[model samples]
Target: MKKTFKIPMSILMVFAIVFSALNLSVFAEEKESNDEYNFELVQKDDNIVIAKATHENGDELYATLDKATSEITLEAVEKPKGLLKFGDDKTTKYIVKAETIDPALDVVDVTIIDETTKSELRISPEYVQAQLPVLVPVVTWGGRALLLWLMEHALAMTIAGITAYVATDLISDIRKSNKNYWPAWIRNNNVYIGGDAFDTDYQAVGWVKTANSGEYNLWARTEAKAKEAANKAAGTNVWHQGKPTDGHYDHYHPAKPLVTDPWVVKLDNHLWY
Candidate 1:
């Protein structure tokens, strides 16, 4: 018969405890999250959008909604410390005066710059796709928000044909409501909804054909007016009603002309009249 040596139960118990401790350490290592992003962009309300960058983790950033370009701008702000709860600071708010949102592009058209060198900020494509859609709706307008949202959905629903007809009647009732009046040049018609050309409010309208950007119509019969209106309506950028001699940047000032009129001939390197 072969003699067999018995293993100690105490040693076996010690080995078992060691194995369990090793497994727990491995589990913790797997559970730790990779939070490398610098800011968390969140929409607090319909008119409240902000980026949180406190303590560890995000790039120091602030957001701007430019009224002139109808787009959002992201700038590098001094990284703030401690807790930044919503509505605590005015600097975090996104709206500039008379801001307009471009509905055709993704949720918001974000532009960033290298203020250090005045160049475009280098960012990955992954960031654009991940963040822009859920950002910057923190604008306050009662019906205009609804109108813009409807327009965005309408644009998304059809790209080529459906929108051409659907857009015209989208906001008919809302147009008559006095509070939400930002004059848009009425598409395919010669009339305006909220007011007239002589009203002289700061109009910030975008060029859109396939969706809801149509507003007030034209009453003037002059060829210059017609051409200006056409260029404004037909999606050509850099065309708007000009400021008058009085230096007021008002719309369609009668007997006054554009900063650079499409009709006027310049005296540079050409035949002078």
Candidate 2:
């Protein structure tokens, strides 16, 4: 008879406690879209995007995206750009089947607007948290960091780049309210700009997915590792890295311009002291 190795529950509990102290979150490039921030997107063109939603007041919100380029800067450093308005509301943006982003939307530029101020409402973060909690948020690596980055740089092109770079199926699944997700193995390398599959050249958005798992990677962890974690938690051998026959794991980065924003600069600090 074959014997199975077993550890006492008490020891496992200790490991869990130690792991909690680590708070070792894995930073990833793409995040899973969920019901929390649902938004609808239509590719008007290869680059143009149109977002539409019925407001809480049953009015309407029609936002046209010029593009999300890394070059987006304040129109003028001396003055502030005007904000597109939203009233008092909280709901996820509908999403699936994303359109590619053009590398040129300005933070100060106006594309979406309401004829009246009563349509889409922006509520307090606290209120939104209280009202609409993410029962099961499908966050990416460094999930909290991604949220913080978005809150701090909502108008930055990095947001668009991430939207573009994230796994397409994760984006598509949110609309279907699906839990199972998949990604194309070949197409997801680095941003393919002006050429075929070259390991250089960046996309216009400039932000690539970097990790922060406290392993000194200066980048995000891999989906393979994520699955490995799940396997450990489940006490199963579900995580597979390439195959036993193959030596290398399957993974790659994606297209984008290089962004050196504050968060990115901080990420680079890993390379320094």
Q: All candidates' TM-scores?
A: 0.24, 0.23
Candidate 2 is scored at a TM of: 0.23
- Candidate 2 global Cα RMSD: 25.4
lDDT of 1 by residue, 166-244 (tens): 2233234443443322233322221222222223211322222223322222322233443344344442322244332
Report how far residue 14 has shifted in candidate 2, in Å. Answer: 73
Q: Which ten residues in a row have the lowest lDDT in candidate 2?
A: 72-81
Give each model's clash number. 15, 31
- Candidate 1 TM-score, true structure as reference: 0.24
Model 1 alpha-carbon drift over 4 Å, by segment: 1-58, 66-73, 77-106, 122-273
Expressed as tens digits, the lDDT of each residue in 117-174 for candidate 2 is 3222212222232232232122111122222223122222222123322222123333
